[model samples]
Each structure stands twice: as C-alpha cells, then as structure tokens.
Target: MHSLPPLAALKAFFVACHAGSYTAAARELYITHGAVSRHIQVVEKWFGVNLFIKQGQRRVPTPYALTLARELGGAFDTLSDIALRYGNGGRNNVFNVSVPTTLSLKWLLPRLDDFYARFPDANLQISTANTEQLHIIGHYDLLIRRETSGTEYSAIPFLQDHHCLMASPALLKRHAIERPIDIFSCPRIETLTRPGQWNLWLKAAGLDKSAGNGIRRYDHFHVSLHAMLEGIGVGLGPINTLSQEISRGNLQPLFAKITVAPNQYYALTPVGVQKTLLHRAFEDWLVSQGQRDIKLADLPL
Candidate 1:
C-alpha cells in the first residue's frame, strides 16, 4: 500500500484550501482553528512542501497546492460516488432532496407530511442551500430550483413563479392602496438579491419604474415576506412561494389584472438516476401536487 497522509489531515488541507482560512475550515469541519492548522502542518510535512502562505490574515494556497486540491477534490468526488453506488445494498430506499431555503420553508415544508404519508417506507432527507449552488446535484436524489435551460440534468417544470405585489390586509387598509401606484406611499420591503424585481413589476404594470422609494432591503426573500406578513410593508411576492398565504387571506394581492413573464420552478435529477422508481415516484408526485396548487390559467396574466 502507498504511504498516505492521515485522512483527517487531508480533509483539513482540502477545507483550508477551499475556505481560504484555518478558522473558516475549522468552522466547516467542526474543529478548532488550532487543530486545522496542525492538520495542515501534518499534511505539509508528509508532502514536504509548503501548501499555503500567509497573505494578510488569510492562507492562500500556492499554485502547486491549488493543483493538488483540484485533483484531490475530483478524487474525493469519485470516491463519494462509488461509495453511494455500492455502500447501500439494493434495499437502500433513501431519497435525498435539496431545495432553496425560502422554498423549503415556505412551500415544501408545509406539504412534506403528504409526501411522508404517501411514501412512509421511503427514507426521505431534505436539505436546504442556495439554489444557485445546486447545479452539481451531488449526493442528492433530486433538487428543486429555478429552471435553467442547461442539459446537465433532466428537469421537470414544477411551478411557474410570477412576481406580484403582496401585503397584509391591515397594511393595505392602513395605506388605503386602491391602485398599484399607491404602493409607493407605504414602506416597500425588498430583498437584496432581487433589487430589480420592483422595477420589473412596475414596468409590467405600465407605471414609472423609478417612482418607488423608502425601500427596506433584507438579505433573504423569506425575511422580506415575513416583514410583509407582519404588516411592515408591501413586497414583491413570487406566486409559487406565497400562494398558500394568499389563499389563506394572510396576504392580499395588489394587482391581479396584470401579469409578467414567469421564472419556472423545476425538479432536477441527474440523468443517470432518472429511471429509478423512487426518483420517478417523487418527481411524479411533486409535479402532480404543484399542478394542483396552481393551475396554468390561475397564473396572473
């Protein structure tokens, strides 16, 4: 057998390289910064090379270290794939799904019981992360994300998300917002990630896009939606994410007469695994449930 550094040391090295600091690596690995540094030192001693250099309180990987990291990352990915393929016997029934945090909390979690009820025997694991980072589809049986036209995976359109103005009934009553233009008179809740959303909605509504002011920006859509729900202000709500609240009268739609092009929600699965029974069943159920929740004609137009 070839002499190799300890797996922990290798892991620490990889995390350090990826995270760019011992402290960050430690946080990710659930160890102390000192431990991460020692692990890196161990790996460096085994390899007889300086893997990183201090640059303004950050550990920057050397060119050779970067090359090594790339190779090691690929190796780890391959090993993980192999382990996932054969580690669980044919009886393995676990289905792993990754979804965006907002979508998970606002949409999926509410209906997860139905899924569990239908597939009680199937082990289900749901993880939430940024949707943009889900393109890799690693270690997940399925991903729910905004539809991309890429051919990397087989995508099933689940929900057509249209942006609309939404607010609590109390907020509307307080502001006396009888028309779309009246929304600018109240506090406008916006998300940092989608700053242009209000402009898009305004332009679609045939109003001056630059008219709104006093915008309060939050880092996440869920937080912004919560602010609107608590009667803080009006927010640009994606129909798919706020449909249940609107249906329940917690949020009132500002203008249901105008509609804009929609960003679609898609259920993505790796091409090779699409034929699996669990994958197919989950996809079918998700699509069916999504259709039942919002019909095409029901979409604002």
Candidate 2:
C-alpha cells in the first residue's frame, strides 16, 4: 500500500483522460481546473510517464495513457458497483437505465405508469441516447437497446422487433396498394437510424430496391411513424412496439406477410455485478410486458 500512488491523483487522471479536457474533468469532480492539472501531474510523476501532449490548444492523451485509462475505467467501475451494492445496507432502490430514443418514446414510456403502479417505491432514472458511451456500466444499472455484439455482458432478450410497411388508412385509400408493385407510387419514409431498411424490406418482398418513388428521411422510427400517421408517407414500423397504434386503427400494416425480422431488443446488465431485488423485479416485469405486447400486436410471426 505504501508503494501505491495517491488514490485521488489516479482518479483525477482517469477522469481527465475520459473527459478529454481538464476543465470538463474539473466540472465533473467539482474541483478547479488547476487542481485537476496538479492531480494529473502528481500521477504522471508517480508513474514516471508523460500522459498527455498538447496539440493545437488541446491536450490529447498519449497512446500509453489511453491504455492506462481503459484499465482504470474497469477497475473504477468494479469499485463503484461494489460500493453501490453495500453502501446502503443493500437498500439502494434507485435503478438507472439507458434506452434508445425511439423505443423509449414509443414503447417504454407508455408502459411506465404500470411499472410505477406495481413498484411504488422504485426510483427509476431513465436516459435516452442514440449512442452507448464507454461509461455506461458505471452510470447505468441496465441498458435496453437493440441486440449488441460481444459476450462481455449479460444481454437478456425482451422484445422482438420486426419491421413492416405501414401507412394511415387515408394514404392506403389513395394509393390503391393491392399489389406489391402498387406501393412504388406512394411516398416512402425512411428512418435514418436504421439504414438500408427500405432495401431490406424491398428485397424480402421480392421487389427491386429502386421501386419506390422517393424517400423522406427521419432520424428515428418514432418520427417516421408520426409522419405515416399524418398520411405524409408509408414507412416501416416495428409491430410489437407499435401495438398501441395498430390496435387503435391509426396505422395499418401493408403486406404483413412481407415483414423483416432484423433484430430483437435486449436488457443488458454488467457482468459480475450482483443483481439487486429491484433489478430482478424490473427485468421480470419488462419480459412479461414484452410477451403480452407481442400477443396483443397479433403479429403474423
């Protein structure tokens, strides 16, 4: 323990490397920028290495420093998780979750009231982001997103996401979309987040990719779904997530048999961390909700 560098300096260096700037690190640590720099200098001196180099009015981490940062990140996350687990005598009911944007809006939000009704004592902090950050394990207790690669974490499949062409009743009436070829005449809406979606659907339907007139691009599925509901165009929609809209007759699925199963939604938890009772409760509830929604959606499977 006597040979160990100062814990504060190591923590500061770890944070500064990730934050990209000493000022940002200072803000996060509630310390002055100079304090952060001094802490980093202490770490550099203890380690006998140059961790950062100035480049065009900004400091960039050296390759060796980035390697150290990765190691420190995992160590810190493990320490934090351990602290969180026993810090309150295992009474921490505050669960943090990260979810993709469109899914949060279309599916999760609608079902949250029921969750609160069941677990009134549960404190849920939900964040919606398009990208998963490296610090997700440290910041969030769970992540709900499309299937991700890698076996580093435990990913439990919850919901099935199969996309099909859909449009409002009014748009369907005007387009005369009886045959697959008739769909080319109507406006096509594309979700920018799900690239190559239109092509995938077209290929599945045995139609040429260039069949549609033109496409209006939206960043997320919820936005494109809204455009479809307004009769702006016909777009691909996930059946299970859009169960409410489909059941209410706001949007009608076209050629339901031509749907494509791209991927499924998953609830991921960091490996090695002990799951609290709250974690198990929420995950079980989510799985149950997904099963019920799939049946309600009446998907062709």
Candidate 3:
C-alpha cells in the first residue's frame, strides 16, 4: 500500500505555499490558524522534513517544499479540470475561460451581459490573470491574451487594440501639449506589465524614448489608466477599450495621426482539443462582437 499524509494536511500545505503564509492559508481554507499549523505539521512529519521555516516575520517554504508545491499545484489543477470537464456539470453549457486582468475589467466584463442575453443557457466561468499566469493556471476552454510571437495555442483574433497618447482633459490643459514633443513635460505613466508600451508609442510618434520628464510605474494597466484618469500623468491608452471614456470627455486622445503598437487580442485554446458547441458559440459571438465594435468605432480593420 502507498503511504501518504492526510489529505487535509496536503491541502493545507498546498494552500499555504501559494497564500504566502499560514494565516492567509487558514483564512482561505476556513480553518483556524492553529488548525492550519497542525495540518502542516502533519505533512512535515509524514515527509520526515520541515517544509516551512521562519524567515523574519514570515514563514518561507524550503526549496524542496517549493518544488513539491509546484507538482502538487499541477496535480490539483488537473484533477479540478477533469472533474469540471467530465462530471455532470460538464453536460451543461458551462465553459471556463481565462482572460487578462485589465482587459476583463475594462472590456469583456462590460460586454458580458450581451453574451448572456444572446445565449441564456450558456454559463461562463471567467478567470483573470496576466499572460504569464495563464501558462501556470489550469485548463480552460478558452483564454484571451494579446497575440504574442511564439504562443503554442491555436489563436483566433478576438479584438483589435491600438495605442495612443491619452490623458485627462485637466491634465492635458495643465501641460499645454501643443505638439508630440510637449508630452515630455508631463509625467509619463507606465505599467510594469507592459514596460515597452511607452517606448513603442514614443518611437512611433518620432520622439526620443528617454525624453520624458518623469516616469511613474504601476503594476498593472488598469492602475495606470486610473492614475491617468485622476490626472496624475499621461499614458498609452488602448483605443477601443477606452472609447467611451474618450467620447464622454473624461480623457482626450492626443496625436490623432500617430497611433502605434497595433496589436490584436486572440481567443486561444490548447492545440488539437475537441471543440464543443459551447466553444463554437462563444467563439462566434466574440468575433462578431469584436467586429461590431470596430465598425461602430469607425476604426480600420
């Protein structure tokens, strides 16, 4: 017979690795902190080694523990995917989709009602993560990500994205940006996730990349967009996603002729996977909506 630690202990340890602390894991697992500690202790004893050790005020997983956690994460994810795909729930129109965080917040989430109205029976389980996280996350019927050079999945074009300089009306007024060069006088807001965006926009506008007065970096595009809306700085705004904000005069797109960094969002699925009716319906709907958006915005294909 195979010897194994208690299932509860393994679960506690797994959650603790990702949660970053025992207390956080306890909170997530709905167990007392002492109970979580006890569970982890059981796993440690079963393995004949310490999985976590105190480092300053935090408990850090050992290297061996980190490796174990990675394997366990994949195993648990596979199990979850299998259950979701083959269980009775799978017979329904339930579909799991992973999307980028900012795109989901600013774009897809707003348009989901339309999808629901069109197909009342379709149930979408949406998860948001960055492009990097999508690689580590579990199985999904579909994923929305920017078109990258070497993606392994089959990609279908979902949306068009073009970047242009944009800032709040008040901020633009304060900065007196009469020309592309004048933007350097304003603080340049950037996202840590897409550090090359500012450079790409600047280069497309025929300006030096290093000419900005100051750089402020946020961890995500949504945060940077919010900062720009607050008149903290100027940022590269995604034309299609922020169209409403521009139309309402909340923000102003500058340099009408200098739009750059044309990228497309793609609906991706693992290569060679069977496509179900749910997948076909959602994909068709997404493409139709994306096309309609471009047509209504009077943007080029």
State the lDDT of candidate 3 residue by residue for 1-301, as single tens digits: 8988887899999999989888899899999989989999999999899999998987878889989999998888788777767788668556889887777887788788988898888778999886545574577888888764365678889789788888898897788988889888879898998778877778877888776568888987888999999999988888877766776788787775677778788888877667898798889988987875633235322
lDDT of 3: 0.82
Instruction: Supply the global lDDT for candidate 1.
Output: 0.80
Q: How many backbone clashes does candidate 3 have?
A: 0
Question: Candidate 1, residues 1-301: lDDT per residue as tens digits?
Answer: 9999998899899988898888899999999989998999999999999999989978888989888998899878867765665575855666778888888888888887887798887777788885466555357778888865577678888777777788898897799888778888999998887768777788887899778688888998878988999999988887767778878889877676555547888998766664578778888888877877654356443
- Writing each residue's lDDT as its tens digit, candidate 2 over 10-53 gives 99999889989888899999999999999999989988999999
So what's the TM-score on candidate 2?
Answer: 0.69
- What TM-scores do the predictions have? 0.72, 0.69, 0.72
Cα lDDT of all candidates, in order?
Answer: 0.80, 0.82, 0.82
Could you tell me the lDDT of residue 11 within candidate 2? 95
Clashes of each: 0, 0, 0
Q: What is the lDDT of residue 33 in candidate 3?
A: 88
